[model samples]
Target: MLFASDLDQTLIYSHRSLTPSSKADPILPVERLDNRDVSFMTQNALKLLQELSGQILFVPVTTRTILQYSRVNLQGYGICPRYAVTSNGGTVIQEGCEDKAWKEQVLAGNVNCADVRDLLSKFREISHPSWVLKESDKLADDLFYYCIVDREKMPYSELDDFALWAGKLRWTLSIQGRKLYLIPYHVSKKSAILYLQEKEGLSTLAAAGDSLLDLELLQQADAAFAPSHGELFLQYQMGVFTAKRINNQGIQFTRTSGIGAAEEILRHVLKMLD
Candidate 1:
């Protein structure tokens, strides 16, 4: 089976999302930035990931820019996922290098780049520098635009308005913590996985994530899961796509959230496929 997963919050997690433990040696750090550890998973979760890496094709699907994604060190854990969908599907990585032709196709054909650019400019014009970290704002390889924001200061109404504006422009807005994303409809994690499926003839697929960006991927997968602590979970409670969880098909919810949920989903996948 080919496993497509979101990195942050699903498998890897920042300290903020990690469960506070009284016992030491409970979790292992998996990602670093600026010589400091940032993302982690439970020790058991790390072991499961290593075993899963050996058992199947693993692909990390993320909204992170390639540079940011590269900061994650999976090499030591026997988890060398050569194929990664980065920039939220703006670029595909093969052995740590971008597949230029595929990237070009994604930019020119898949994403309506011109329309996205026009919309991005308008967002920039309206975004207040107080909340929108303008310096962190970047147009990701022309496929999407995103910025880190001061979430506490950013008004919810503004975000809701932006989401509507994005929809009108055939784009999607995703707010994962401080990182706010404006992505074109076509440049998506699900589309990227479908491209891989068509090329590699992958049949059985499993996926895990805890964000709106992952909804399409989850719905399309043979077996998919979401943690109890994400936008989708709230949506599910509000009767959005509740049948998946109710029917035990397509998508399901995990008992835990954050890194704890990471291990739970992996165990579920192994059990299902076995």
Candidate 2:
């Protein structure tokens, strides 16, 4: 079985403290979003994640640059995922290590690297806001990409407009929680997971997430879920895909969300195999 989830608000909270600072309080994972205090995950969600590790392969997909991703401390989830997709599909990291083969494949798929770089640079020059603090390349172990701007000063509306315009260029524009990332449109979380499946056969699959970057991954799963806060929930309301909410209560509810409404999704997969 294969289980995949986005990391930021999906797995570990943003602030991500290892243990509670004060015992009397709820063990919420702290979220450092928009430079404000926000809770990332509930205590119950953490426990359910721990138990699910045994039933399926756990994969984390996130847009976080490899350096920014390393700062996170994931301790109590009980099990470590074997495959992690990072940079929105630019890289696929092996559990407890890094993998270079995926990036090579992605890069090879696109032949016009120089043209892509030139177009991206021009986009930054014309559309970027004046408050741009810094624009820099995010160098992975094997992949190279750039982030648009720092959220501390840029407004969401401006970013949205930039994204809308950027899309016409045939480049992928993604706003993941905070950072605005532009990547090749062909890159996607689902393709990365497929790469994993090709290498190691998948018996079952489940996925959870809260954003557009997750759209492709959700499509790849037998069962899929999103928190009430996820924008994808709105998309689901428009009759897009199959997903249900698990409460903020933590494990018991998450398991119910996964195995209950999503159980039939699993059964569907079993039937397909049979």
Candidate of highest lDDT = 1
TM-score of 2: 0.67
Give residue 239's lDDT in candidate 1 (0 to 100).
Answer: 83
lDDT of 1 at 146: 77
lDDT of 2 by residue, 67-137 (tens): 66654444444656777787777778887566778877887866734346565566566445554435444
Task: Candidate 2: list runs displaced more than 4 Å.
Answer: 15-25, 28-40, 75-77, 112-114, 131-169, 176-178, 234-274
Cα deviation at 95, candidate 1, in Å, is: 1.7
Error of 1 at 236 (Å): 2.4
lDDT by candidate, in order shown: 0.80, 0.58
* Lowest summed lDDT window (length 10), candidate 2: 250-259
lDDT of 1 at 267: 96
RMSD of 1: 2.6
